[model samples]
Target: MAHLALYRAWRPQTFQDMVGQQHIVQTLQNAIRENRLSHAYLFSGPRGTGKTTAAKVLAKAVNCERGPSQEPCNECPSCVRITAGTVMDVVEIDAASNRGVEEIRDIRDKVKYAPTEVRRKVYIIDEVHMLTTEAFNALLKTLEEPPAHVMFILATTESHKLPATIISRCQRFEFRRVPLEEQTARLREIAEQEGMNAEDPALAYIARLSDGGMRDAVSLLDQIASFAGGNVTLEQAIDATGGLPSEQFARLATAVRDGDVSAVLQEIDDMMKAGKSADKCLEQLMHYFRDMLLAQLAPDASSSSGRVADPSDLRQLAAGFPREKLFGIIDTLNRYQTEMKYAAHPQTMFEIALIKLCTASGETPSVQEGSAAGASAGGAQAGVSSGEVSKLQARLADMERKLEAALKGGGVAGGSTSGASASGGGRSSGVSQAPSKAPRVRVKLDPFVAAHDSPQSKELTAKWPQVLQRVKEERVTVHAWLVDGEPAAYADGTVLVAFRNTIHRETTERPANKAMIEGVLTSVLGKPAEMVTTMQKDWQEALASGAGASREEAAAGEELRLVPEDGTEPAREPIIEEALRLFGEELVVIKDD
Candidate 1:
């Protein structure tokens, strides 16, 4: 006889043999013993969690000749035939393969007939979620109102895919993944029974690799036992599975914490040379970091049964990393993992991710303990000194105060000095002098008011979104600054925009940014145009005061005039005007002696 795989050989025969699902087992057993069986049942859970096995066991229990008992008498003809799958009444269907409406219609037709060889006609449909919509519809009526001698058991790993109508008709049981301890113990029991020499660590590792699936753990153990000729060791298990040991992960993590780029690259190269795929290496490293985080957060509650390394070593390694740094590392790994999926050269992507981790700010372990103060100090040292940051903040506050004063004064302090004065006594004078103030550039609202409600202004408003999009396409930085302004008026080839944010208006008026916006507007509007910006509050005040030019004055080319608070126009040079336009009234601080 051919050797049966351990998973099949060790399949659960009854509810008593099932692990990690006490609630489900007890519920089913009580339903059977009390004669409260339902016509249709839905079993859903992860694979290898005994959904199908429990269905088979329930079938045998209901059909046993001596009694419909909690436990099936395997010796009875009904139980034995069902266990061997030789009974004509017990039918098993793989919905993945036979999921058409015709097949379901056949089942619907057969469910009406009485059992030929058993007490009840049992229909077990595995992967029931794979059934087509039509197939589900076909099975609905039969499942809802089957004959007294018929029972339907629907099993699927993904219960969400089943229709609500089908689910409502059945009694649902959820099977959970077998826990680590129970799964490991099962592997050890199988090893001893099969006369294989497997170490406890090897069993634990295989169990962990299975990710809570008993069949997967058993199959892995069988494969490793065969590969090692009945003597399975941790090294042999790792090699056979192409998995990295805990020590390698520890070394790589340590290198990253120490900011050792060369060491990190060398470790990746060694792993690549040893047949480890880049994506797999990244996945394992992510898991290792996750374990480390969990260990630190819940030290006593963390279990070491399936960890790659000892709990003490993990805690020790975790001490070197601050929580914030660990968060950044995990985020980087997650981002790179997503990108690596579609990358043509995964190894290159992996290397880049490791290098980023090594060089990221505050990645290196602090010289002192991993406290908040130490972390902050380390970050400051890595980027900017705290003293310099404070000085910069103070200067910014002073500038803001001066700017507010200037805006309230309704003028910008001018800095332009006459060349003759600069060449002579200006440089030799020892006496200090107060700064001179330049006149504010007051926009004459006449032109704007004359054209504010014109057809051109309305057209510009309609196409404003398109203009912003074109600006974004041409230069995103300009768009970011320009988006805050709205079209207020259009006149004499100049588009007037009102901005609520002073800084945005100032930035948008810079030569390069203004040129970019003008180019986009010209292209989008199909006409030559220039842009002029004003503060929204100022525009509102001007409109309320009715301070605007008449249509005749606007047509005569009166647009903007530089007037002082005393209402006198100053003789300003072109360079000075350019400076005022670029820096705005708030930022262009002018000093004179």
Candidate 2:
């Protein structure tokens, strides 16, 4: 307890000592000069960004021996005790610990008194957001009519939680998280003072890891210094942080750039074996990939020549990937992150991810392109071409076999191919298996179908309210999902019920289940849409077809639609029920809800 942590020891005692927030300091200083300070002030911002520090400094400045001056002469008994937090007049309270209404009431009662031993009574409440609403209301009235000798300095990391009415009564100052450049410079100064030789890149790395918080950066530096004999080398920094060296990540990125899945996988395995976390590695790669994507798609981030961090390695990887392939890889990684989030062993996630990423059609765009080149070369005929052409053609033909081998071999890129062709430069975008053609049987809806509205159709109508709107507006795409397709009727008398197949026999989809269908259908037709649904067979031939294929993508919604907005309907897969396809286009029309 005798030795303070570096963060505490280096705590800014005066406005001049604070970093990255001259604007806030200048305003506070001017306010003191003009004697325009508020009776109650709210200091709010991110942690380590000086909200508490600013509050304490402001308190010291106000109670300084020399009339409410900007600078607190630390030598004054009042200043010294306040700084030491030993003064009876300057009370520092952790609202987090004393948030009950009774505690607030005690403060309310005490506020009427003058300073106990200083010029003014300063009540500094840290984490004021923790105060209950009742506590806040009690304090609010007291604050609005505080003694002239009393000042309140309320600091909170989350100002949003404070009651707006309370906030409106106090002068508020927002502290922002420090910027990277500021953090980097501050870390450099700290390292210099410690007599440690820290590289610029290493310092930059720490600054970034700190996420624009000077205290965090200093703490990390202190950690690195203690663990690495007081000299924080870049390698030591990466080792301590499990941040894979930029060099190694760059190498892996290079392989990705070259469209080498095998190399990418090998690199991942090697990193994982080195005790670097697979999840962390994936996260780093994600960040790197994001930088690259920005560099690839945005002119502003294109070059280090123009920007601070070029994200070159990533840009190269992105450039090597086709647009579609890039998007696909991103999608796959997103899915992987979601699924493996809670997995106990993340290593397996990346172990499989590396394998998948290498041969992954999306991330492995270059590989596919190379494979296309090889396949084109191998298919070369009596009219075929040269050495490079043949090599590429050969690769194309054996891609699946090669990919399968890579997956089994921890993701090696260069496998000796017996079918090697002497070809190159024949790369294509993607090499997905051609989907066999399926007949398009366009079933048109009856012209009479308006925005359908019928009480019986209410259930189905309510199911996809968004889709109904889109269909009526003739939006680019729309597909009615068919979870259950059956006929049901209910209206004082008879109703017809039919299902597509035994599979569609679920009671939910069954028309016999009267509660499931009939809604706004009548609104569209001015009468009840006599609900009639029956399972129907595929009417196509050449190859005997059945009802619509399961997993039918709704074509009603526009392509590349946004992932559903918060609380909105999801772009879900259409259900595979028989009655749905039977009456697919002829289901009750839509009308206003």
TM-score of 2: 0.60
lDDT of 2: 0.60
Query: Model 1: which residue pairs collide?
Result: 414-438, 446-549
Angstrom error of the Cα, residue 262, model 2: value is 4.2
**Model number with the top TM-score:** 1
Write model 2 residue lDDT over 1-593, tens digit each, in one string.
11237678678899988998999999999999998888999888887788888888888998888768887777888888888889888889999999999999999998887776888888989999999989998998888989899999999988999999999999988888787777778888877887888887777777777666777777788777776887788778777777877667667666755657778778877986788777777777666665556767773652322112346545555676566655666666766665466555677776666557665544334455567545543443333456635544443444445554566877423421110110111111112211122121122111112112335435444443542443233211111223334223222211233345545333333322322233333344344433333333321220133223321232232121112225343221121121123224222111100
Q: What is the lDDT of candidate 1?
A: 0.77
lDDT of 1 by residue, 96-213 (tens): 9999999999988878788889889999999999999999999988887789999999999999999999999999999898888898888888999999999998998888887787
lDDT score of residue 25 within candidate 1: 89
| Cα error of candidate 1 at position 550, Å | 36
